[model samples]
Target chain A: METLFYDYVVPCVCAFLACVGFTLMFNIHGMGKLIAGVGGALSWLVYLLAGSTIFAAFLAAVAIGVFAEIMSRVRLCPVTGYVLVALLPLVPGGGIYYAMRHCVAGETQRFLSTLLHTFGMAAALAVGAMLASSVFRAMFPRLRRTGKG
Target chain B: MDYDKLLNMAAELGYQLMYSGAEIYRVEESARRLLYAYGLENPEVFAIPNCVIVSVDTPEGHPITRMRRVPPHGTDIELLERCNGLCRRLCAAPPPIEEAQALIAALPEDEPRYSPRGVLLGYGVAPAFFAPLFGGGLADLVSAFLCGSAVGVCLLYGGRFIGANGFFRTAVSSALASLLAMALVAVGVGESVDVVTISTLMVLVPGVALTNAMREIMAGDTFSGLSRTADAILVASAIALGAAAGQALGGFF
Candidate 1:
C-alpha cells in the first residue's frame, strides 16, 4: 500500500499541484484552473501507467487532448490553454539538460542519442495531441448547436 | 454604418485575440465570422503569429483593409475567453459598430489578472512539486523552490537588464536556474543536482510553442506553424546553450 501511494498517488498529486501553479502563470482562472489541474494529473497517471517511455508521453498527450476538448465543450472555451499547460511535465527538460551536458563534455555519441530522443519525445507529444483533438472535433461535427462556430 | 469602422473593429478584435496567444485559425475565423455577421458580402481575414490583417468590401463595393501588428505576448486565457465570448455575442446579434469596438478595446484592461507577486509564487511552486515527479526527495524540493524563484525573479524583473529578446531572456533564466541548483546541492541543501535543475528548467521549456505550432499545422495554417516550429527550436537551443554555459561556469566554482 505504501509503495503504491508513493509510486502512483504522490506523483499524481504533485502533477496536479504543479499544473495549478502553471495556471497562475498562464492567467487561467475560476473553473478553468481546476480543469487544467485535473487534466495534468490525468496525463501524468497515464504516462506512469504506460511505463514512462516516449510512447507513454504520446498516450498521455492523447488523454490530455481529449480531456481538454471535453472540458472546452463543457465550459464553451478554447482548448488551447489546458492542452498547452498540461503537456509541460512531459516536455523532456531533463533530456535537453543531459544532452547539453554530454555535448559540453565532448561525448558525441551520448549527445546525439539524447538530442534525438528529445526530438522524438517532442514530436510524439505534438502528433498525439494534435491527432486526438482533430479527430474528436471531426467525430463531433457540431461544436455548438447554436451555430457558435 | 461606417465601413471603415467595421473593418478596423474586426481587425482590432483579431489583434486582441492574437495578443492573448490565440490560435491563428481562431483569430482568422472569429474576424471573418464577425464581418459576415455584419452583412459584409465578402471578408478576408489573415493572421500570422505576430500580425493580423483583415480586408472587407463595403456595401458600395469599396475595399477597406486594416492591419494590426501585435507585440510579443504570453498567453492570457482569461482575456482570450472574454474576447471569444464577446465575439460570439456580437456574431449572434450584431451590435452597433461603436459599442462593439468599445467592448473589444476594453478587453485587455477589463479582465482580471494575477498580480506579479502571485505569478512569481506560481513560478516557485511549480518547480518545487516538479522535483518529486523527477524522483527528488524533500531537500531537493526545497532547493528547487529556491532555484525556481530565482529564475522567476530573472524573468519578471531582470527584463531590462537581460533585454526584451526572448532568446536572451530564456537563456539567462536557464543559466540562473542551473547555477542555483548546483550551488544549493553543493551547500548540502539538495540531494540531486539533476532533479532540482531539471525541475527548475521545466519553467523555461518550449512546450506551449510546440503544441501551438502543431495545432496550427493541423488546422492548415502551415506558414504560422512553420514559424512557430522555428521559434520552439530556437528556444530549446537557447535552453541547451544556457545550461551548458551555466555548467561551465559552475566548473570554475
Candidate 2:
C-alpha cells in the first residue's frame, strides 16, 4: 500500500495540481480548468501503469487524448487546452536535462543517446495523442456534431 | 453586403484565431465556413503559422484579398473558445458584418484573465509539485518553488530586460531556474539539485508546440506542422543550452 501510494497516488496528485497551475497560466476559464487537471492525473496514472517507457508515454498520450476529447465533447469546448496541459508531465524534461549534462561534461556518446531518447519520447507522445484524438473523432463523428450543435 | 467589409472581417477573425493559437486548419476552415455562410462560394483562405490570407469576389468579377500578420503569442484558451463560439454563431446566423465585427472586437476586452499575482502563483506551484514527480522530497519541493517563482518573475516582468527574443527569454529563465536551484541546494535547503532544476525546467518545455505540431500534421497541414515541429526543437535546444549555462555558472560554487 505504501508502495502504491508513493508510486501511483502521489504522482497523480502532483500531476493534477501541476496541470491546474498550468491552466491558470494558459487562461483556461470555467469548467475547462477542472477537466484539464483531471486529464493530467489520468494521463500520469496511465503512464505509471504502462511502465514509464517511451511506449508508456505513448499510451499515456492516448489516454489523455481520449479523455480530453470526451471532456471537450461534454463541455463543448476545444480539446487543445486539456491535451496540451495534460501532456506536459510526459514531455521529457529529464531527458533533455540529462542530455545537456552529458554534453556539458564532454560525454558525447551519452549525450547523443540521451538526446535521441528525448526525441523519441516526444515523438511517441505527439503521435500517440494525435492518433487517439483522430480515431476518437472518426468513431464518434455524429456524437461530436451533436455536441458542437 | 459590402464584400470588402466581409473580406476584412473574415480575415480578422482568422487573425484572432491564430493569435489565440488555434490549429492551422481550424483557422482556415473557420474563415472559409464564415465566408460560405455569408454566401460567397469561392472564398480562398490560407494561413501559415504567422500569417492569414482571405480572398473573396465582390460578385462583379472584382477580387479583394486581405492578409493579416499575426504577432508572436501565447496560447489563450479563454480567447480561443470565445473565438470558436463567435465563429459558430456568425456562421449559424450570418450576422451583420458590423455587428460581428463588434462582437469579435469585444472578445479580448471582457475575457477572463488571472491577476499577475495569480499567474506568479501558478509558476511557483507547478514547479513545486513537479519536483515531487521528479523524486524530490519536501525540502526539494520548497527549493523548486522558490526557483520557479524567481524565474516566473523574470518571465512575467522582465520581458524588456530579457529581450523579446523567445529563444533568449527561455534560455534566461532556464538558466535562472537552474542557478537558483543550485544555490538553494548548496545552501542546504534542497535534497537534490537535479530534481529541483528539472522540475523548474518543466514549465519551459515545448510541450504545447510539439502537440500542436503533431495536430497540424494529422490534420494534413504539413506546412504548418513542419514549422511548428521546428519551433519545438528550437525551444528544446534553447532550454538545454540555457540549463547548461546556468549549471556551469552554478558549478563555481
Q: For residues A1-149, could you state the per-residue lDDT of candidate 1 as single tens digits?
A: 99999999999999999999999899999999999898889999999999999999999999999999998898888888899889998999999999998998899999999999999999999999999998999998644544373
TM-score of chain B only, all predictions? 0.98, 0.98
In candidate 1, stretches whose alpha carbon ends up further than 4 angstroms from where it belongs are A147-149
True contacts kept of 1: 0.78
The DockQ values of the predictions, listed in order, are 0.82, 0.67
lDDT for residue B120 in candidate 1, whole number 0-100: 94
Q: Which candidate is the best by DockQ?
A: 1
RMSD from true fold, candidate 2: 1.4
Off by more than 4 A, model 2: A144-149
Pairs with backbone N, CA or C atoms under 3 Å apart (clashes), candidate 2: none
